[model samples]
Target: MQNKNIIITGTSRGIGYEMALQFANAGYNVLAISRKTPQILIEHENITCLPIDISDENQLQQVNEFISKTLKKVDVLIHNAGSLLHKNFTEITTQEFQNIYKVNVFAVAELTKICIPFMEKGSHVVTISSMGGIQGSMKFAGLSAYSSSKGAVITLSELLAEEYKENGIAFNVLALGSVNTEMLQEAFPGYEAPLSAKEMADYIYNFALTGNKYYNGKVLQVSSTTP
Candidate 1:
């Protein structure tokens, strides 16, 4: 059987890196995109590491060109690249907020827009969100910017689901809880998470492979609730 093609962002480290490896191991052709393509991902014969900053217009165009000319079809898109700025509500500047949105929200929109032409009937798009984005959940200080961006992501996915239904495309957001990743460490120093990056990657990979069968336009919260 021919391998399916998947495009993943933030492949330099953490969940994105692990997902790329796991997807490749699962016999998928993975196009790993990052600002800096990690050497490890490049070494994987099934993975093609593309160095493109999603927030940069020129670089994003390069990705569009590559996908148009090279890939005939894309099966899945995992949007994992994001920016989290820990700051009090008052301290968060407009530019800072926009920067986070650039990677977390706008980048996803732009890439998915360009890739729509290449996606077939069964294509799935998943964006990695956070518990902070979940409405009615406990709000944390110094996370207003990040949380806001994630909220946008959830809503965007929902809207995309409606808009792309005619194309048989599925859009979902994984509102993940704290995972043991570099991003988590930077946000909350010394805090331990119930799940590791590899574990999260495994779940995400499986979901991307088969999630559309059950749900679309949903924000699936992934986390351990035990206190």
Candidate 2:
């Protein structure tokens, strides 16, 4: 997939950063977006780093305009930016739920809407969901908001895949398990490492590059049964 133009959100660190590196290594032109620009991205010849909050509509519009001018086509779009709120149900305020929805669900949908004009048939859109979006784990108190937000992402991917089927666009969700990222560290503090970010990125990159049409609208889980 040399010379494929890709747009990825949440690239300041963690899974997003890994994805940017992996895609760039594969010779894809990558547009990496995050609230803050990372130094490593500055060194990548095929990567353009955009520092903008995904949740802001005006900024998203600006990003859309910039991408339209810079790239002829968007072959891939990966939505990876999200927030986690680890608080009990009762402790979560209305604002907290709204904030989670804003970042996790709304931003993804809105960005996809804006980017669709720049995409065409053979374009792939992947959302970074979680196993938490698939099945509820035991005693995972304080994760209701996070889980629910991810569930929305899964549904969004499915609906987008269905809606764009005639256009030859593919949409899928990567429902990941415990990846050894800062998000996981915060969720399971002091826990042993699970999977390396590069390994996870490799898996996701391969999936996005080679997945068949039938894989569209499916949530593919990536994780080992044992850490």
- Which of the numbered candidates is closest to the native, going by highest TM-score? 1
Error of model 2, residue 119, in angstroms:
1.3
Which candidate has the highest lDDT of all? Answer: 1
What are the candidates' C-alpha RMSDs?
A: 1.2, 1.8
lDDT of 2 by residue, 1-227 (tens): 58788888988888889999888987999999999888889789988998998888888987778777888688889998989989989989999999999899999999999888888888899999988888554336789999889989999999999999898889999988877888778877987666887788888887777773558898887768531
- At residue 168, give the lDDT of candidate 1: 95
lDDT assessment of candidate 2: 0.86
Q: What is the TM-score of each candidate against the true structure?
A: 0.97, 0.94
Measured by TM-score, how close is model 2 to the native structure?
Answer: 0.94
lDDT of each: 0.90, 0.86
Candidate 1: residue 196 Cα off by (Å): 0.3
Q: Residue 154's C-alpha lDDT in candidate 1? A: 95
lDDT of 2 at 127: 93
The positional error of residue 123 in candidate 2, measured at the CA in angstroms, is 0.8
